[model samples]
Target: MKLHCEVEVVSRHLPTLGLRNRGKGARAVVSLCQPRPPARGEQAGPHSACLLVSTMKDKRGTRYEQLKENIEQFFTKFVDEGKATVRLKEPPVDICLSKANSGSLKGFLSAMRLAHRGCDINTSLSTLTPVKTSEFEKFKTKMVITCKKEYPLGKNFPYSLEHLQTSYCGLIRVDMRMLCLKNLVKLDLSHNHIKKLPATIGDLIQLQELDLSDNHLESFSVAFCQSTLQKSLRRLDLSKNKIKALPVQFCQLQELTDLKIDDNDLIQLPFKIGQLKNLRFLSAARNKLPVLPSEFKNLSLEYLDLFGNTFEQPKALPVIKLQVPLSLLELSARTILFNRIPYAFHIIPFHLCQDLDTAKTCVCGRFCLKSFIQGTATMNLHSVAHTVVLVDNMGGTEAPITSYFCSLVCYINSSDMFK
Candidate 1:
């Protein structure tokens, strides 16, 4: 269930900051981590255990076979009617069947079999992709390739290994087995039926940006997660996928500057997201998140898009205190009274306050760090997700109500938040 992103145009036009994808084609043998999920049987040695795992993988691929059967059924109907047309889902997967002769049907069947790599998933991945091997090889020397727009125009461009844009090709699966484009800097494989990304993509260690938006991918593979190729990635777009949670290995990308995971089924962000200190932009709109970690304040985000989420207002604040005590934020909360701070944020107030209104109640004992207000601790407030849940789960004992402030002026004059 990948969701469309709120702000995508910014990065598309942002010039690459001089980090070129220069690499020596030192190819590494890429392999998929065998998808593991069975309990090792008792009395089996590591060797026998490996064999059993192999057998399980072979059986696990039956779903792909089922999909192929469904498609074949669609073809059966088309062939009988001699309609020279095929539709996969009642409509919309219509294939012209290319003139309906027995040879044409056989050719179409061959193409269908090649396209359906479901029997062996990786066999159809970004590598060994039989879809456009000739096209990829024809302009092997060019720096960038834009296929979707090019294919319809019937035009060809010089291929540069630096960038590849293959949008709306109606590609289901591709084999990247022969792909070793060393200088590849960015790859846009958006809006396709691709459910899996080949680990071979990691071979492009110089690749700095990757856009995998609007694909059916549930999650990235473990092999790709562990790959060193991710180290060079400064911006990654994984919008509109079925991903529910990020892999723990995601913390490896310490240099990431931009990340967009909007419109997904994410309930919560990875606990290690704070590790991406270089991040300047984050868009997680339209998710199921209940709350963001307090560690979020640590990031120096330039642009943040969090609308359409389950996020409530940020924790209420009577006065905000500067953690590093910078000269800018050290105005004693009095100097900036009625003036705006640099940043605005939101948070959920599920269990802390009896009333969720920001102006009336200090739900999180915090407030907009952006609103300019005086520093004073007179007003009352409560921790939004903390104190209440703590009291309820902590033996349901009555706990003392505590009040904290980010600004005294903001606390007393909280109505400005509505502005």
Candidate 2:
């Protein structure tokens, strides 16, 4: 069998002669050829079962060496995912083959071992043809399509694809074929006509950046917010959509560093927006948001823009909802939050687990459930950002944000900030 990979040849006897050797690798096709039987009435030659390495740059053609006689040792070492190294012995020189895809390397190594033992390979000769290294690379890692005509009509995407882009393709919905690309890291579907997203898009657990900007989406899926995307999504763009609101569970994507939802119809952001500790750049410009969430003060940002929003004026009196005896559900949730206990659907009810996932945190370093005192206070946008954009054409940089208090004493102690 023939395998395409990067090949390096090291001379074992060159170093002892006090000479520097070639320190570079080249693209090569390695093949295992069976012994050709002598033709009728022709004298037998020294040809035997051999392994051939044809380097693309080598001026002297293919290097053919008898596998059983010349090779003193043959072994393989794994370097990392999708990479491996194979060492071969050729008396005075050692041939090192590396940077090969794991699948091809394994097959090549197995065939080499069997050929070295003088066994007959049952494979067809057509499968042993050398393939151009450039062609191999083009099929393996990434695929980009900017026009609708370039998209594949089949159900399967290349299984090795890590980055796929289909921008300006006029797609009305996410291609179901794309859901099978589990290795995908960055998916850019921007400038499409997609009106809705498949909840299964979150099945791509390795996805880091997803761009669905300039679409016709009217709502973001809560199922997506609760999917494995929470662990991998780092950057997202939903600009120029018709989304009216984002689910509270949307804050579960704590890994986000850059977010853009500009030119949407959002009424308000997720209530637990501050849970995203890694968020640094935020732009929600031209939305219909009336006020920011109570936890907006918890964000530490490098840049923030809330321009063109009509923010409400803060009221003087705090809205009180104190419970003399906290409900059992509230008490249980508080206990779980205070102790930092981990919960999942398997360990507790799914709804209860979701409640804990979006639990409110008070300014006093405590968590609160439904029983808490609520207040609205005006806050300077500059307090949470190093660079702040004016919230309106009147040069206003202040907006009202809600605040929650766990108890009457906590509200009384922090009431001066509201005034």
Candidate 3:
């Protein structure tokens, strides 16, 4: 195979380069005056890749029109996308390509080899835009796909999938039976143009994590929340979209631990969101939320990102540091309140909803620890799980030592410290 390329020398430093010996100084620039395919097994993008380089000439230093297109039209198949300029450093003019067509890398490689009729052209393959990524090479299925094919909801997808992440593909749909990847655990479809998922998505009963961020989806299908996907789905991301309201079925995702709805136009979240008893992380940043639902006080959320919202800082909301990951009260319960004011925020599950004066016992009914620090005697809780309750002002004057320590060691240590 030969490359229909043009090579011309435009520069020569005979003295510095040691022309007598030849090839002895700086790197000699080799200009690629025509598009060239990447090395064997080297992947190329759907778009044409153009590479430009300076021409290193001999003693004569001849130049040609300062012209030559170094574009590798390796991709034999392409559909109409739009006209866009692909610039290169040395190759002054840009080399455009056929519209994007999704296809098989193996086939593309075979076609590229067939295109070359003569000598090879040397250039970096970085300038090419990959339509399908190297992730394709990892496929175990025996099917061969090509770029000229439009994706249909057919049954030709890979099988026995566990993880799949396809991003920036402008994808609109996928094969339905591929959802038959029952063992699939994680699937990321970020940065695509998909608007809706097929009902067959439920076939992925074992899918635990799904990322559909940066898409055109306005809402989800009813089957998504009602199907087996609801039982095993643990994480979901719906960020950067035009979704205004979530379907009521979303509340059925009881096993969901993390939910990201950032950068959307959501005015409010589903009222039944508190039903997710296991939810730990929730990010609703950059939305139009004015006030949170009262049911929100029921769930124990460790990390909540509500910045860039319309709601004012609620006094009942505990102050949260954006940089620090929030831990349960037992881990960060460093403050003790007794006959003194507690200016710093604290996380505790002392049942603020109940009549504090009548609720003589701690939320967990565990023993409390009393200690002396700074010449002041104070009582603190040794360790207890968090109860999602927020209070604005907890004056020390109203507090009384009435709970028991979780362990005898805590009691003895506090008693020894006080003594």
Candidate 4:
């Protein structure tokens, strides 16, 4: 078949028009027709180029406008979430509060009268007004209010009326017994003379971690034992408290890997402690524990800090296998405490063979040296006639003898031998 061809000029402004080798800011001849000479006197190539450029510009402009609109919508959704303005303070600073979506904003602020520095919302007016934080005794700012109706403004701490004083009108005393820190993740009342945690503390369903160390807490319970966050809890620092016993329900925290109960008054651990299958690190150091539970044998625990406890059963710790990959086993038995090794290759029972197969495999391996004991049995000489047994590979492939080969021996034992 005969073909026709024609060369046409394509402008730089319409770069998408399939023009080839068009120099910067100039036009080049792009073919419009194939395999035939242009019709006589029909050299209208440049005229056709101008029409294509106008059409390409319209298409490109519409695409650019659509992309710009999508970017603007993305920012609008994020801004509505209050993501740009809400800020949370770090440690040694006030905890940031998230806006409440419940009830009236005023009712929420009235409830959180302990937040001494943050803005208080007025639900009736739908406006947030700045709060007047009162300076209490000893130069410590009252940033958090707990136990409402119990700790009233300027009641426990004598604040002067001359300087900036906290609002006492909306401020109700925090009831320590009915303590509710709902929606509160991190609470820091450390170094304070506070006495107790509210019983309603179990309501904090979203709490993932807790730090109640260095307090005068004498006893606590498992009211939050069934909380969904129980399994999600990974870290717990209850050191320096006056706790006397470990709760059995605490074993339900299967995901807890780090637990610190140092400097407590715990006497013994509940058997349920063994149920913590994921426990990797535990510190009961400086406590009054006389003996660890036999249940500790089932734990896959790797690190245990029992530095100051009286290891009552140190000699009887055989029930617990030290099979954890990297364990730092501390054995503090009364005045006989060991911080370093006395000899190399101590051959402790914890270092014994882990399983039967591994022990048998090692015994049959090439590293065999000398056996201290040897034995052989003739077993009544097997009666009237003399019997001889021949053992060989029997022309079969010789890879290695293993547990898998024992199946043939098992099969023969199940079948009749002389029938």
Candidate 5:
């Protein structure tokens, strides 16, 4: 199952300084660490030779001393490598590795003080287990619990309270402002309770794909249209939302190739949408769009789906005077239809009723023509096969082929014309 985790950071200290100095407020750094489980073969049975040895710790001193020794041993090389060293303040008792005998929680609490002062322990943390201590709450990052503890986190397990001084701290919420996620390349806050995103989100210069689907996003972050996003963004999924209209900023996605806005409250698309030169696939299915702009005719697009839209009927095209030699001009579709007229003769029935702006051309061959008649142009034949071959002083430099039977001609060849 895919999950969307929204982590919110609440700054406990709010200073009156301007944006410049305000960033300097002291704060606790919170980090969430998910533990790694031991490998399958690492388990020991009663017959195992390693289990035969008896291990005991004499209570000559506090467990804190043991934790300090363990941390120091783990980070010796890190200090030599110039990384932060571990420094123990209140060391913990014995750290038991046996599944039956758990380690002392208080001893683990003191071990954190040596995090970056004396050893590589911080970087070598293959797995981190928090100790049960009131002071441990000072760490701000929300702890994503991956391991199930045999016992609860003490008396304050569920509704615990701790007093710590920091610039940011707390549980996640729906509306967050200026969340600095500059390093994020792809983000999916889908199916979340998030209500709003700050306009400064465009500050993330490296973002390539963002999925805000299935949210209560009544509005959009205009910062998305910033120049930084316009150049690199490729995919944007905003389906299942309450958005009603496409903002003009949407046109700024010049590099976008796939755009999905299906299952929304949108009534119309932004007029500048056709300005996307690299658009390959566009899905506006299940929308309330009455009609698509004629500008779509100018697109070199190959695939388009307008299923489940409010377009009661197909749109009509303005009668255009064919100017270019449309013979070489290819209006491509997966299939072609020759309407009420069968594929018996060269004269093909045009589906002018479907999309008139497209000048459907015929392939001067056999197999291609057979498929054109039997396969392509199957759905809504009336809309796709009824093409009209116009005869005039337009594309063909040869004088317009005029004849009383011109309109009656079944197959309008490249050299022929039909007005």
Candidate 6:
């Protein structure tokens, strides 16, 4: 039986003295076999089987260690993930064999245990041999394809794949096979012709960076905003798309740090955009945004760019739409938000849940829905960012930001800002 993997041999007898290959391990083939018959006039050895370790480097010469004499204790140690160590006692010195690839390591340990017990291994030879490499392993972890011809012909991607890029591939839709890559961390489908993304794209729970820029995506899916991606996604690029609006659930991705949605048809960002506390870089240039969201003032960014956007001028007076007595819907929504109650499609009507999620937040850190006053105020971009770009050719650094108030008293308290 043979196992192929990296190996490192350490001697416990001489701790200070360095062996031929000390710290760095080498690729090797470890095997177990029956002891050869004694030669003419040679005394027979007591062992029924033997273990051998052979290095793979031919130029460095083969190194063999036979474990037949003075064999004491044999046991395995789980050093770490994909790694194990086997230790054998030989009177004066202790031999330690360490390697990686847990599958191979487990098989080797099983064979070694059987050999030490003087019993024949009942396992098949194919099971004992090293695993053959799969076609998917050829790409290692990162795979990039710039054109259709470069894309691999396969129904599924390797689960080991972490980063995959298919830019300029002219793909009209996301490959369904890629949704199975749960271990994926980054996926770049930029410069493609994709008109929409599959909801299953959110199944990649490990994904961190997603680039769908330069596509024909008309709108971001609400399903995607409610997926597990909200917890994992850190960087997103939707630049040069046809996306007109983003779902309010998009703000739940608090892990986001970098966002680029430049050159889109976005009329307004999500109302709860300030929920992304980690955001540092933002670029929404060339959009059709009329005014920023009420929560836009909550963000603290390192870089801000709103150039080429047609922002509306601040209004002279706030629009008063407050209800004399808060409606039942507004009161219930406020209760849900204040109590942090978890709501989903399974718990209530989908539209009701969506309305609650998209509810507006007042300047005094309270939520409002249907019974709030709407107002707009001019805000200097430099107040939120360390570096700011001119919003237009007029060298304007200020843009109109919307605000909401849950009550008449709240609106009166913030009325000075509209003057």
Candidate with better lDDT, 2 vs 4: 2
- Per-residue lDDT of model 6, residues 36-80, tens digit only: 545689743324445555553332223233344335665455532
Once model 1 is optimally superposed onto the true structure by TM-score, how far is the C-alpha of residue 75 displaced, in angstroms? 56
Score candidate 6 by lDDT: 0.76
Give the residue spans of candidate 1 off by over 4 A.
1-160, 312-419
TM-score for each candidate, following the candidate numbering: 0.40, 0.75, 0.40, 0.37, 0.37, 0.71
**Model 5 global lDDT (CA atoms, 0 to 1):** 0.39
RMSD in Å for all candidates: 23.8, 5.5, 19.3, 28.4, 21.6, 7.2
Model 1: per-residue Cα lDDT over 329-411, one tens digit each: 33423233334233222442343221111211122334433332332221111222112121222233121122333445434
* Model 4: lowest-lDDT 10 consecutive positions: 60-69
| Candidate 2 lDDT over residue span 204-315, tens digit each | 8779999999999999998888799889999999999999999887888888999999999999999889889999999999999988998888899999999987677877
Better of 1 and 5 by lDDT: 1
Q: Of 3 and 4, which scores higher on TM-score?
A: 3
Indicate which candidate wins on lDDT.
2
The pairs that clash in candidate 6 are none
- Each model's lDDT comes to 0.45, 0.77, 0.47, 0.36, 0.39, 0.76
Candidate with more favorable, higher TM-score: 3 or 5: 3
lDDT of 5 by residue, 1-419 (tens): 00011111212222333222222211211221222334787632111110001111211111122232334332333221112223332342112221010122122222343432333233223223333234234322322222224222343221111111111222123223223333345555566555666666665555677776777776666676755888878878888888888666677789888788878888777645656888766666677766554234334444555566654332122223332322321222213332322232244335532232222223332111111211111112112112212111242111111111111122334232222
What is the alpha-carbon lDDT of model 3 when measured against the actual structure? 0.47
